[model samples]
Target: MNSLQDALYNWLTIKVVIDERPDDTAAVETEKTFYDMLKDDHSLTNIEVTKDDEMYYVHFDHEGERKKQRFPRELIEVMLNQINQQPERYRNYPI
Candidate 1:
């Protein structure tokens, strides 16, 4: 498959939120882990994560435009774990 096909077939859906308040130690750590996974995963592109006032913002580019989504702090860890723990059968296949 080529880039177009890869982009067309590849999809990533996540729940995230935005808050202005500073995050606690645990939340901060989860954020770090989330970012670490993003960095380690080369298949991800045009992704952004930010937090303020307890709200977390997650965004990534799809097709030609950027898309955004929100998720609560409590659920970020869960989402992170889900992404990190994707089963071998669900992982992207090399073209």
Candidate 2:
């Protein structure tokens, strides 16, 4: 997967773990994994993820310019659906 898709897959995986085990400290590590994956992209810096009532916002610097991308809930769901079709691509178990 490309960097963005990899980051989102990690985000979704950790989110499921967080929801299942809210008190698990290891979830923090999984969250960091998402950021670290994004940071590995040479073109991106200062990456951040935020959410409001309806959308997720990804902010970063690309090639020294600031940029942001918004992903609607439906878009995320669509990605999740696609991911579900090939669980082994992102995770060892079903998300």
Candidate 3:
């Protein structure tokens, strides 16, 4: 299934925004885990995690210099699977 969307997802900046609960540590940790995995392995950039008030945003810069993209996970599973498959593709993005 080499659809264009799948290919785009490979090189897209994925931004995930999630609501927080009283104890959001696990959620934050999970997001961090994803970011670290992507950063160390793939060419993804700007993998940032930010929290404001009651919301959290995890954003990564897209894979190419000519184009920048942000990806919000439709669900955690799909995004993680994509990231896992091409882990080495997400590293050292040019500034």
Clashes of each: 16, 0, 12
Assess candidate 3 and give its lDDT. Answer: 0.44
Q: How do the predictions measure up, each by TM-score?
A: 0.35, 0.52, 0.35
lDDT for each residue of candidate 3 in 5-84, tens digit (9 for 90 to 100): 34344433232312322133444455465455565555556654554554434455656543333344444235445545
Return the top candidate by TM-score: 2
Order the candidates by TM-score, highest first — what do you get? 2, 1, 3
lDDT for 26 (candidate 1): 42
Please report the candidate that would top lDDT against the real structure.
Answer: 2
Candidate 1: tens digits of C-alpha lDDT, residues 1-95: 23432222122222231122123344344445554454354244577667566555667665567776665555444544653576352343333
The candidate 2 region of ten consecutive residues with least summed lDDT is 86-95
TM-score of 1: 0.35
- What candidate 2 gets wrong by more than 4 Å, as runs, is 12-23, 74-95
Backbone clashes (count) for model 3: 12
- The Cα error of candidate 2 at residue 8, in Å, is 3.9
Worst 10 residues of 1 by lDDT: 12-21
Candidate 2 global TM-score: 0.52
